[model samples]
Target: MQSTSNYLWLLSDILGQGATASVFKARRKQTGDHYAVKVFNHISYLRPYEVQMREFEMLRKLNHKNIVKLFGVEELGSTKQKVLVMEYCAGGSLLNVLEKSENAFGLSELEFLIVMECVVAGMNQLRENGVVHRDIKPGNIMRVVGEEGQSVYKLTDFGAARVLEDDEQFMSLYGTEEYLHPDMYERAVLHKPQTKKYGVTVDLWSIGVTFYQAASGRLPFIPFGGPRKNKEMMHKITTEKPKGMIAGVQHRENGPVEWSEELPVTCRLSEGLKLLLVPILANILEADQSRCWGFDQFFAEANDILHRTVIHIFSLQQAVIHKVYIHSYNTINVFMDAISQQTNIPAPGHELIYEGHSLELDLVQQVNVVPKTTEERPIILVSKDPMTPIGITYKEPDIPMFPPKFDLINDANLAKVVTSAVHQLLRITNSLMKCQDFILRGVYWMLAILKEECRKTTQQVTALNVKLNFCKDTWMIIQKINSLLPQMNLTEVGDVHVKLQSTEDFLMSISQNVQKSQKQLDLITAEWSKSNDIHHKDNIIGKVQVLLDKVSAIYHQLKKDRMRMKLQYNEEQIHKFEKIKMGIHAKKVLVLVRDDCVQKYHKLLTSVKDWMRTACDIRKLLGPIGEQVKNLNQNLENCEASLNKTLDHCSSKLHDEEQIVTKLTASTAHLDQKCFEMVIGMKQLKQEMEDISQELQKNNMIIQSGFQEA
Candidate 1:
């Protein structure tokens, strides 16, 4: 067994003790190299030698610039203490530094960048090597003074390190209370913490927490009140938003003291540096793990920042080598100056007669540029591939698949009006064609006659501000004649009233449908007023005029129907008078006249009912057609827009494809030139070698001839 004095001389002093091992300050017996030695008690205490060996194997594999280096391990037979030797950091852990240096590291921009790069680089290497230092905290980070001006940081404590390459479960009370993630805390609370199958990303998250604390001078998360406040604080770390209050507002009103606010930065940094640090801190402290930047991305960004800093500091390539300047502008101002000096294809709706073929030239696009100085701008030119066949198919853009129009008419009331009008027209037309009975034929003819009369009335009604007084006066005159000539009647008044009421109700039922149709027409007119299609505007205008004429015809028809019905009333009155005036029981002409007047009134009512039904039918047809015209206008506009988009997409793609073809052609030309030169060089070299061989042979022949003569 090794003597106690032999190892005692190596230890600086006892530092602390824990459940598994006791820590001591140790030095090399000969070289006086200082180290922290953690000696585990016995084989009984560490029965799972396999687990310890696995951990030791992982720690030994970690050879990062920032990680603490392992020295040696010894087994003391007598004491059965497994001893681990490591390089000692005299400046102590980050926690000790925080306590001594007043809250945190007051690092400047360059210094912070340097430290951050070192930390990220170390962690990145660890992750790449498939190792995870699960227990990352301020207590594990050790700052050591370097030779002269160099400052170095060491990431110590690999006892909690795990190799993720293994499929085995890794569970242990492995991390400090203040650095565990919320998930880790919950698991610990349940006593079923995930000890295995955890990844290196977890280690990265812990490091991010460490960074947040270091930058802001205080922990990002802190608990208000709890028995084990530090443990609660760690749970709050990655979950809660830090209430960054002033220094004086640290304590809670009804709870224990949480953390102080973010301590002020003593490190005077520039705006660029502040911007850089703030985002990093925010990312580090983000609650969502997915949001946090991965170690690879973080290091890449850090490397770029560091390179930019270096460039700024060094200020390389400041002087110009060779300078040339020129200013030129067009001088010609002749009237015959060509516009753009570019070829023009025929506009849309025109045929391009090319190479004996009648080709369609669609004006798919147009562009206008307003340059600052027209004289300075270069003239644009038109170009095309000379080799392409005239009849070759040009590609077009794909059509976008969108929902059907009229699906937008979501109001039930409007839909009913539209559908009802269309269906009623269909029903009326079908009934007129299919009905075969004599009564049905007479009814149909009467309805047709009433519609024709109403059409004449509509002409007068739709005219500018024409009053109904003329029609009223004519009816009054007819009534007076019936009264004076023994043709007036007053019976059947109830039937007249019932027929009038029915006509009024039908009119009322269709009032909204008529108004809706009018509104849609008005909207179309308003849209056209703003902008019109250059080619088809006049055609649409003509169609609108035809529609207006149809409406006027229907309006005049209604007016004529009203006038004819009044005439019919007069005829009915005359017939009733003939019956009542004669008395039929021998000469009661007075009573007969009164009965005739009643019949005339009933006839007027019947005519009005028939006229009203015809008017309703006319309005229904007009309303739906008006709606159809409006819908067609909207669809045309949508088609125009979609066509414009298609044109743009096709143009862009064609331009890109042309550029690729140009590049390929250039490459092919270069290769052809190179091959030609190589062929010429080979011919020249072959001729030169032949000449040399001939000269050598001639010299040998001369020597042999000379020797033979001698």
Candidate 2:
């Protein structure tokens, strides 16, 4: 066993028994600081190694103020038994506080907020570090009472936590009773391990349960007794509604007295805060896990909540006003100078709406709003454009009057703009097709140049072979004449020697001329073979192979170019189709507006109210226009569908074209192989001619010696 002394602590006694481990109270010998060490047992469950590994991975990485700090870990020499050391809390668990304070002081709103904030802080930290506290309950939170009844809270327990991933594998058995997500129940019944497929929403659901009971002093959904069956618990979690108070309790029927009776609690709690917290909690508890906010969103919201809470705790009015201005941007710049005097606010950007004419406001560089003031400044609200498109008619080019109110978000107009932008993008894409064409032409030119060189090499090689053959014939003839002079017995024929010499001279000259011609022809042939067209020819074969390769490459490139052209053509067609669709949608909307206007014109003839008459006429005209607009939209959708179908067809054709191109490449390679063989044959013929010429020269020399002896 590993020595306990090495861990800088001494185990005083066993603290408690847990589901998967036992907790022991230990104190650091050096500092005398107490800690709770949880020992893990492997054999109690199957696949203990995997479980322990997971636990260690999660616990070792956690670092947060509200979260229980892990001091260290100890492992025995060979056993799977490992001990996790953590900071000890003296105020016991939140469960004890809840039980004691259920009726006494009734758990005030401020107190509940404080405790819940601790839990949220710990959770927020875990989420930022990419961890989840899947099990969040009153028992997991430990409270430490300071002097004069001040309590400090910390979050503990991570046996059920899960890390999120794009495709994480989770074991469904994680989480505890009354806190398990609805998905966990489904997973358990399905007998499947937890998958990292889920987001951080799972942890949020557990936190919601913790927060609900803490504030209301009762479980939001769970039954009051020991534990309910799976069916009962799941029903409550899924279908049960929020109740004002716990059941079967007469005195505490209206919720905790301190929390419920406080008409106005701390300024920290705002309507926005309540509104925000409820939805998050509800979403986390959703039976469908898909809708839950993942860790990314949770962390963002938690930070915002913390920031807001901190500002409130400090009684900083500027922070509260800054938060309000962020939500609503109208008339914010009017107070910019006043706000800047006390706070660190700077000039705002596109997201902010300036409702005043202040050149000075624009001059400032920063955007943070600060300080609180009551003096109102000169305000000028600039209205945004309406969703309804108004036709521009110029009688003498007059500026249009702004509307009384404008929607910052124009849903219909936004869609129209997007459709227009898409059409423009399609045009740009069509232009890029020309680039592909240029590349295709370049590739084609490369192949053409290679093929021409191959042809030239092949012709030169053929000419060389013919010249070699001619030299071979001439050398054979010279040898015949020389042989006759030696047989004529011209031993004393010093005069005969001269005649013999003349014949020898003629033969030597002929041989010399033939040798020169052969050398020239060989040089020409070798130079031709070295061309890029023939990359690898022994003599004739390499040149031939190069020619074939050039032809094949060109053919393949041509086919690819054709496919690319087709794709470009299809894209153009789709663009035209989409434009038509947009035109139709716009026309239909115009028609609707016009029909309504026309109807109003007819009603206005009898109405006493002049404004009503005008409005009625406008609406009447808009009706038929609307019908036309509807038709245009339908036609546009049809065109879009057709274009999409064409795109699919083009994709399928591309695949088929690729296969054909591959086949063409293979056939060209085969042709190259055949050409190589032919070149090899030419080389062998040249070698044979050289051997014959050498033999003939030796015969002529022997004949000259015989003539001198005679």
Candidate 3:
């Protein structure tokens, strides 16, 4: 036991090590209470007294659940070495957790959320106390397991932290290089002479980089070589942006930024989470300090996510998964409203099923939903409308196996036994043939339904494209007319024009998406035509599902764009502009165009709902067909083997061998005829699918012509 002046503690194990200090797990002799003792090394003692005391002062002043609580400073008994004792965190540092193989791709969403909440709370406390933690990284964050075995993260290691106001500038270089702000990075890593002082916003950059790494398991910016080997290249990539370069990401030093808004494939976050998180990252990771969001906005955005009730929803009819973010206190109706907005389906007509039981909307709340839900077991949404077909669930049926051997037989009863075995084999094959025929009919019907829905959806998309073009042209005209009006308020006009331009770009994007969807639909149809095996059909169904999800995403974006445009085109603004002759005409035309767009959008939503229903029905039908195909093939093989074995045995044992052999051969030939017929039916079904694809193309052309005429 190592005794201090007033306390006795045994240093059991080393917890961590750094350049200037080493922390050890220590226990008190009296109560056996555990604590972490951070002992300063020779290097730390050489620092200026004020610089060393800054950490102890900061730790003493801060008090929060998310910040590590500081115990007292103590001295070793005989050696008289000074040490700082603090609350012990059993779960270790967050860096240790992140380094685990299970978290190689990053922490799970729930765990990441916990980290975000704790870090934000701790940082908010720092802001309140007017302190800056210069070194804020994963290594400095410690995790403590709660009574319920949940992780609670707290900030520690304030060695580089100091008291600094929001506007105060610090000239001292600190923080890990990879997470440093560009200005700091230039001085710290590139060895460039930097005269500018860093403000509190530097922490925001570190937080951004840390959060991004926690989610993606890798740094955002990387040079062709590596972060350390190509420090100058990283500096250039961080500071310089060529045309068309994406912010905060550079795979190669001088190369253009990759053209993707998505996180890396290694990221474990869901699409819905990425949607909410990426915007925050964009605001915080800005190289320009003037543009970066302060802690206030960061807290607001992060808290909004933390406080929400997160649940994954799987639409059984659409065969798509969606993530819903809502207030925990909200009822199921509110949750359904969010789902409706995402899916473009009516809220009243949704029936949520969980764990094989229908959830009572009036009795359940969003808070209760999350605890019972998981990624593998999301709440299932079923359509309540009677007209909607209920999807058929499939289970593999038990297939009977042939007996390993025949019962004991003699030459006297050989003919009787052989005849019975041949008849049994024939019956089994006949049953399989009938089952195959039934599955084939179901496949054909579902395909026809899918084809009709695809045709309707394609036409609706075409009509939407035409309407969006008209709206764009009218907005352009409005911009021109508003510019020419001498009486127009230039600032107000400018804001509206910016909104209009944004809407125009969005509309253009929608047009491109529509064209892409059309091509995807055609490809799916072509694939369906060529599909003969169950696995091939499954792939085709998945493609259709992906296309539906894309359309739903477009629908939601359109709704948002329309609302913004409507708000910008306020009645008062229109009346004010209507005084001029040209302005009056263009303003009225714009109003007409907006109304037309709303109507078209609603129609598109209806088409999408119908399309999802049909596609789901096709998938449901395919499931059972796949099962039947496997069973039929297995039984056919068994029957053929049994028949051949019986014939060989009877020929060797029976006096009338030729007659018995001839009868068995006839039965085998008859079974083959049935299989041939089933194959022919499948070929015919393929031909019909090809015909449907042709008709879809022809209908698309007609639909375009009608839209142009309108």
Model 3: per-residue Cα lDDT over 420-439, one tens digit each: 22222222222222222222
Rank the candidate models, highest TM-score first: 3, 1, 2
Q: Which stretches of candidate 1 lie over 4 Å from their true place?
A: 1-12, 15-19, 42-44, 102-105, 108-111, 165-173, 189-197, 225-227, 230-237, 240-271, 310-710
In candidate 2, stretches whose alpha carbon ends up further than 4 angstroms from where it belongs are 1-3, 6-16, 42-46, 75-80, 102-107, 144-152, 166-171, 187-199, 223-233, 236-273, 309-710
The prediction achieving the highest lDDT against the true structure is 3
**What is the lDDT of every predicted structure here?**
0.42, 0.44, 0.60
Task: Report the error of model 3 at residue 348, Å.
Answer: 9.1
Off by over 4 Å in 3: 1-3, 6-12, 77-79, 241-260, 328-337, 340-377, 382-710
Lowest summed lDDT across 10 adjacent residues in model 1 is found at 314-323
**Per-residue lDDT of candidate 1, residues 1-710 (tens digit):** 12232344233466555556666877665666677776776542654667666546766777877877776676554675677777677877666654432233334444455556667767766777777677888777776777876556777766677666422334554676456655565576535546443444556557756765565445555555432544544454445545332122224634544433344333223333444455555554444556656666666665655553110110001100110111112211210021211112211211112222222322222111111222112111111111111110112111122122212122222222222222222222222122111112222333343344334333322220111122222223333323332323423222333433443343344444445544543443343333223222323223323433343333333334434554355554543343232222111222222343223323333432343343345544553543443343343334323333333343344345445545665677364664454444434433543453354345435533432332
